[model samples]
Target: MGSIATRGDSKRSGNQGMIKTHSRSRHKRAQALAEMAVMVPFLVIGMMGMLDLGRAFYYQISLTNAVREAARYGAQPYYTGLSPACNAIPPATSPGASCPVPGDQNIKDRLAQELSGTGFVVDPTKIQILPDQGTRVSNCGTSGSCQYALKVTATYQFTFITPIIGDLIGNPLTLKTSSLFRTEY
Candidate 1:
């Protein structure tokens, strides 16, 4: 009878230990769930930041190419003793307008148009030309070797998926590019 009693007690103790193990497992599962919920937002923010950075990089590249094109167009001497390859530019009176005759504005306007066609939004009004944006000396003027200038500015607004610091949303991404060249004038 004593041996039988001891065997029964051992079986009960084994079952009790199993019950405790199950309770501890349940607690662990709840902790893991809580941790996951807390970490989700940080993961989302990191992904959004990466996306924003990629867009910024793409816009910067587009701005750089726009400036290069504008400079190339300005380098021509056809209008003011500039090379024929020079892109369209306005007279020596206006420095910013794209069309002065149609009317011709400045070399920058034409370049902006071309670039915007490539899926980027560009506004010439946001840009400033130094010395003369619309003014181009004639082929006979003493302006010497002839120089063409083009400046471009682009801005992009990025919306956050999870704004950790919400107040800074109004600040946009800004890019500026300028091109200056001395072509045949």
Candidate 2:
């Protein structure tokens, strides 16, 4: 049979051990919270950087697609901008009777229409549309001959959502995409 005194002492010791375990658990919880507070900012900033980078990449791809579409439009035989000025022989400066080349503003409007819903604003001044008639080896009057090459270029401004990243990189990164296509006149 166990003595009553010994049983009482064991119970008290068990209670003290439980109290010590509770105290250690509280300390560990506080330490974990402190660590989380220190790490959270860095984690948030990293996530923001990734998000911004993804957005920039998406916009870049969109801009490239827009330019490709615009170039495709210009590559058609019907677009006035694709017509060569003065198909005459060298030294003959007379502008031919073809419809006047569509002005930069017209081309810009077409590009803007293609860029609609992309969340990117394109500047007309930054865009350049040019026709390479001199490079055409085949005669335009011939059937099934590619006449002229149209070149379209534009720059997209990508703004970052996070200020820290913006300061590290430029406020707005300029991403440029150009597309050239031969006209099927």
Candidate 1 yields a Cα-based lDDT of: 0.56
Model 2's alpha-carbon lDDT is 0.72
Error of 1 at 147 (Å): 3.9
Report the alpha-carbon TM-score of model 2 versus the true structure.
0.76
Q: Each candidate: what lDDT?
A: 0.56, 0.72
Runs in model 1 deviating more than 4 A are 1-8, 77-110, 113-118, 129-134, 139-144, 148-170
Clashing pairs in 2: none
Poorest 10 consecutive residues of model 1 by lDDT? 95-104
Model 2 residue 97 CA deviation in Å: 6.3
TM-score of each: 0.63, 0.76
